[model samples]
Structure formats: C-alpha cells, structure tokens
Target: MTLELTPILTRLQNMLQGFLTAIPNILIGLIVFLLFVFISNLVRNAVHAIAERAGQPRGIALVFGRIASWAVLTLGLLVSLTIIIPTLTAASLFGALGVSGVAIGFAFKDIFQNLLAGLLILITRPFRIGDQIVSGNHEGTVEDIQVRATMLRTYDNRLVVIPNSELYTNRVVVNTALDKRRLSVNIGIGYGDDIAHAKEVILRELAQIDTVLKDPAPQVLVKELGDFSVNLDVRFWIDPPIRREANEAQDRVLETLKKALPAEGIDLPFPTQQVLFHDQTEETDGHRTRQREGWPSRGIERDPRPLREIRPNSEEVDNRS
Candidate 1:
C-alpha cells in the first residue's frame, strides 16, 4: 500500500509546486487582460465618435465600433492566454483558432452572410431610413437598418423584419427616391364632346391645384376610343413623392375634373349597347346590303322584309317538332 501511494503523492506535490511557481505569471496575465479590456472599450468609443463626426449613419457607426472593439478584445485574449501558458506558442494558438473559426463559420453560415450583406448595404445605401420601398412581396417604410435585418413599418402599421441578404440579392423599388413623382388620371368624355376643348379644360383645372408641379407641365393625351366614350390620360408631377401626398393629389385632380369638365359642356357618357333580333331563315339572311340590323344601306339592295312577311321553312319546323 505504501509503495502504491508514493507515486500519487509525488505527482500531487509536483502539481502544487508548479501552480505556486506560476502564481505571479497568472496575476500578471489577469492584469494585462483587464488593461486590454479597458483599452478596447476606449477604442470602441473613439471609433464610434469618429464615425459619427464623419457624418456616418448611427447604425453604421455602431457596427464599425463593435468590429473594432471585438478585434481588440480578441487580440488581448490571445496575448493573455499565451502569457498564462508559456507552452502555448503563437503558431499553435493560430492553428487552433483557424480550425475553430472554420467550424464556427460552417455552423453559422447564414448569420455571417447576413452580416456581410448588411455591411454592404450600409456602405452602398440603396435606400435610407424613412424611405418607402417595395422588396419581394413586402412594401413599407424603412424603420431601421440593423446588422442582420432591415425593419419595416408597413403602411397599415405592421412591422416586418427582412434579412439583409434578401434585400441585397433581390430587387427593391424605392418609391420616394426622386424629388418629384408623376401621377396619371384617366378621364373619358362622350364621343360627341370636343376633344381639344376637353383637354384644355382638364389642363387648366390641373394647373390650379396647389400640389401639382408647374415646371414639367401637365400633359393631356388622347388614350383611346373606349366603348362608350373617348379616353383621355392626364399626367402631372407632384413634389415630395410620398404615398400620402400622391393620394391627395390624385383625389384633388379627380375632383377637379369631375366638377370642371361638365360645367364646360363636356359630356361624360355611360356605356350603352343596342342588340337586335332577326330571323336567320328570312330572305335577307345572306344578303349583306339588305340585312336590316347589321348591314349598311346600299343603292342596289332592297330593304329587308317585315317580320310578319317572313316564316320558318319546312326543314326548321320539322326539326323543332
């Protein structure tokens, strides 16, 4: 029993001696790590302040500061670990970290992709906060842009969180990108109404609206001859291209047209159709010019016979029976 216990006791004593001898180094490593932590915080704050002063967006500044702080902290950690364990060489530490990094990258591939995509979006700035945009099947006002996702508050006041990778890869339509946006309203007048006079009235009325921009000038074009009326397309520009403003301008334009066009003797006609019934077995069935309802009047063709003068032939009667 004594011989067996001797080796265990000897190993314990050596471990205790080694620990006691390394106390000073451990203390020094801890102090260095704390000092690095302090310096990293200072670096983070400094980077954030500098970025803000350079007119960077708040979110972008925050991202930059976080990256700087993490880098400093990682370096500090590596240094402290080496100091605490003299056997840990720089090459060994780097090799371990490289393998660990690969594993971590594989584990969180989507997260890293979103981070990179978010960084790119902030740098490129396709759309800013408060801009109304349409992406994929979602459309809303951008509330915030974060490191992983973009927040949107929809027109109906619903919140949406979209990954930055999707925004970067997919198509996005920025509705309010321009200073002024054009809007069109289609109005139809009766075929008998004078097209030129109707156009003049519409243009004059549109110019009177306060929201309409006067620089580009409103346009009135004859769109097409509709079933019951002649369609006219009225187009005009409005400033501060927003959904609310666009809606209000459209409402005002429509109201003005509805009220002013009729006061100027322009007619807004309703859809109307005339359908006629005739017997196919009549003498005028195949006579183009003599057809009562569908054919034009011709000098060589006689008028169609009255309904009282026509009757169904024997074949049609027998079939019906």
Candidate 2:
C-alpha cells in the first residue's frame, strides 16, 4: 500500500507542473484576442467613413466596413489560437475553414444568394433610393436598400419589402431615370379640315405653353384615317419626368388645343351618320327618300310631297273650278 500511494503522488505532481507551465501562455492568448477585437472595431469605423465619403450607399458601406473588421479579427483569433496550441499552423486553419465553408454554404444557400445579390446591386446601382421603379407587378419609389431586402413606398402610401434576390433577377423599369420624357395625345379632326393647317395651329399652341420643351420641338403626325375623322398624334416633351407632372401637362395641353383649334377654324369633329328613308310601300317604287322631321334649319326645307300631288283626290277642289 505505501508503494502504490508513492507512485500516484509522483504522477500527480508531474501533471500539476505541466498545468502551471501552460497558464502564462493561455493568459497571453486571451490578451491577444481582446486586443484584436478592439482593433477590428476601429477598422470597421474607418472603412465606413471612407466609403461614405466616396459616395457609397449607407447600408452597403456599413456592410463592407463590418466585413473588413471581422476579417481582421478572425486573423487575430487564428494567431492567438496558434500561440496557445503551438502545433497549429496557418495551413491547418485554412483547411478547417474550407471544410466548414462547405457546410455553411449548404445550410444557408438562399441567405448567401441574397447576400451576394444585394452586394452586387449596391455596387452597380441600377436603381437608387428615391428612384421610382417597377419590377413584376410591383411599382414604387425605393426607400431603403438592405442586405436581404429592399423597402419601397407605393403610390397609394403602402410600404413594400422585396427580397434582394428577386429584385436582382427580375427586370426593373426606372421611370424617372431621365430628366425628360415624351408624351403623346391623340386628337381627331374633321376629314374636311386641312391637315397642314391643323398641324400649324397645334405647333402654335405648343409654342405658347411654357411647360413644353422647345429643344426637341413638338410634333403632329396624321396617325389614322379614323371612322369619323382624321386622327392626329400630338407628341411633346416635358422636363422632370414625374407621373404627376406628365399628367398635368397633358391636361393643360388638351385644354389649350380644345380652345385654340376651333377658334382657329380647325374642326374637331364627332361622328355623323346619313339617314336614308326607304319608302317600302307597294303603292310606290322601291326608292329611298330624304326627310327632315326633327328640327328646323337655317336653310329652307324641301317639300317631301311628290310632284303633281301623288294623291290627286286627297284634297277636294272647289266644284266651280
């Protein structure tokens, strides 16, 4: 019994000595990790400021900044781990990371896809905040751009959150991307009216309106020989491509054309039809006759009664005759 206890005490003493020897190294590793964390935060802030000054989006800049800081901190952690475990090498660490990356990719495939798409959008900037865009059936002004989603304010005052991946994959129409947009209004003139004269009157009216752009010049083209009248397309350009502005300009231009065309003897005609009355009675030949029944006209009306009085005995003459 005395020999067994002596062997156990000797082994315990050796283990205790090894533990004490490792304590300082563990302490140093912990201190190094803490220092790395502090430096990482500083790096994050610095990157954020630089990107912002260079005109990058706020949300995207922050993302890049955070990535930089985390990368630095991760390197520091690897260094500290090496200090604690002297056998650990950079190659081993990277090999472990590669294996873990596969697992992470499989686990969060959709999340990573959106993350990558969001980064691409921030860099390319196909549409920016405050831009009015239409994607799929959704249309609105962009409010915020985030890593996973984007926020929009619809015309009816509703908020919409769309996934970044969907937006990136789909077609987007940016309405206000240009400073000016062209709009067309169709008006019909009587077939009898002079085409060249009507176009002249339209150009005159367009020139009077200050909202219409003069650089592109207004155009009036004969679009169609419509059923009732000739259709003319009046196309004009306006500045500040906004929906409301375009509508208002259309209304103003229409009103101006309405008042000016007729005053200038340009007839804006409506549909008219010719009524032919068919006398189907067997007593008379199958012939169509014209009759004016509803209203009096400026000119004299034609007597509908036939020559020699179709009915000779309908009116009795005086017997003395």
Candidate 3:
C-alpha cells in the first residue's frame, strides 16, 4: 500500500508543477493585452479632444480616432501573439502579406485610387474648404474632404458627395477664389436708335450700384447686329467677396435701365417686319407701279386709258443724269 501511494503522489506532483509553470505565462499575456487596450483608449480620447479643439467635426474626429485605435490595437495584438508563440515572426507575416498583395490590390483598386486622389487634393489645394467650386457637372461649396469622397453643399442647400477620382480628372472652376469677377449683360437697342445714348443710360444706371467696382469701370461694346436690332455687351467688374450683393446690384441696374431708357425715348430693340404688296402690271412707259384699285393718284394726271391698251416693251431706258 505504501509503494502504490508513493507512485500516485509522484504523478500528482508532476502535474501540479506543470500547471504552476504555465499560469505565469497566461497571466503575463492577459496583463499585456489589458495594458494595450488601456493605452489605445487613452490615445483615442486624446485624439478626439485635439480634433474638437481644432474645430473639426465630431463625427470625423470620432471616425479617425477609432481607426487609429484599431491600428494600434492590431499592432499590439500581433506583438503579443509573437511573444506568446515564438514560432510566429514578422518575416512570416510579411511574406504572407506579399503573396496576397495582388488579390488585395485588385479588390480595393477604386478605393485606393480615391484615397490617393484625396491626398493629392489636400496637398495641392486647388480648392479649399468652403470654396464655391464647379467640378464636372456639380457646383457647390466644398464642405470636407475624406478618404473616399469630397462633401459639397450646393447653393440650393443640398449636400452632395462626389467621388475624389472624378474631381482629379475633371476641370474645377473656383468662382470665389478671385477678389474680383466680371458680370455681363446682353442689351438690345432699336435699329434706328442712337447707340451712344443707350450706352450712356446703361452706364448711369450701373454707377448707382455700390457693389460694382468703379476703378475698372464699366465697358459697353457692340456685340452683334441682330435680326431686328443692335446687340450690346455690357460688362462690369464686381467684388467677388460679395457675390450675392453684386448679383442683386446687377439686377437693379438692369431694371433701372429698362425703365429709364424707355422714359428717355431710347427704344429697346424688338423684332418687327414691314411688308408691301405689289401688282404685276406695267404702265405704257414699261415702269412697274403698285396696285391701288380705288385710291386717288398724286403727281400724275388721271388718264382715261382702257386697261387692255397697256402693252409690254423690251427697250431699255437711259436715265443717267
């Protein structure tokens, strides 16, 4: 009985020693994981605070903070795994990543392209935040630039999310970048009216508008000879910083011109036509005359010649003076 007890006790002691040795490793791994999690959360909170202080949107800040925290935690987990299992190494991880790199690239080709374009836009700064811009067919003020798309607030108050790749390739028109912009109005005048008088009236109206810049002065030029009138091009410089005010000023100027010009007998051009009907009959002198059946004639004697007596002549008349 003593010999059997000794063997059983020896086996139990070996099992207890093995458990004691493994417990320390398990505890160390757990501690490391907890420390990494704590640090990640701290960094995330700090990042969010910084973004908030910098006037960044809370949503964007939270998204970036989460991404950063995930990246840090992933690195920490990889480190912990390596420590726990000595067989797993950075070289093996990189080799596997390289083997699958092509598949990953193909899967995220569009996403990578948009990310690169966004980076380029941020670096080059062709247009900045809150800039009124027209890119491709969309016209709006830029709100933000993210990894995938750029946000724009249209003039109508609609939010537009455009992909960055399209912006990189298409032309972008920045309307508010310059301090001054030009406004053009097409005006028409009657064919017989005095163009100079029309221009003077237009200039006077534009002078009353405060939003128009006086230094550059307003320009009036004859643009085209239209079907029934003369077209004039009225161009004036305006302060870009007050674009809405400038537009209102332009409208006022046009309205004033419309009213004042008409009052001053300066007629604005409109389409008109003058038509005449002719008779296919010729007099004895082979001269064509308008047909008037019952109208009194002037500067000619009323001859009682019969209508059938009228004859055609081919001889040409020499009336050179």
lDDT of residue 249 for candidate 2: 93
**lDDT (Cα, tens digit) per residue for candidate 2, span 1-321:** 445688789999999997898788789999999999999999999999999999887877877887799799998999999988878888998899898998989999988888888888888988888888898888888998877778988888899998899999988898888888999999999999999999999999999998899989999999999989999999999997777788899999999999999998989887888654423222122222332343334465445676236434313222212
Runs of candidate 1 with Cα error greater than 4 angstroms are 1-45, 69-94, 279-283, 286-305, 310-321
The digit string of per-residue lDDT tens for model 1 on 1-321 reads 345888899999999999999999899999999998999999989999999999998778877887899899999999999999999989999999888998999999999999999999889989988899999888899998888889988999999999999999999999998888999999999999999999999989987899999988999999999999999999999998999999999999999899999999999887899664545334444345544665434554433775345534544434444
Best candidate according to TM-score? 1
Error of 2 at 140 (Å): 2.2
RMSD vs true structure, all candidates: 5.8, 10.6, 10.9
Candidate that would win on lDDT: 1
Top-down TM-score ranking: 1, 3, 2
TM-score of each: 0.74, 0.62, 0.65
Q: How far is candidate 1 from the true structure (C-alpha RMSD, Å)?
A: 5.8
| Candidates sorted on lDDT, descending | 1, 2, 3
Candidate 1's displacement at residue 142, Å, is 1.3
Q: Candidate 2 — which pairs collide?
A: none
- Where model 3 places Cα greater than 4 Å from the true spot, the runs are 1-91, 241-243, 274-321
- Worst 10-residue stretch by lDDT in candidate 2? 279-288
Q: How accurate locally is residue 178 in candidate 1, as Cα lDDT from 0 to 100? A: 86
After aligning candidate 2 to the native by TM-score, how far in Å is the CA of 261 from where it should be? 1.8
Each model's lDDT comes to 0.87, 0.84, 0.76
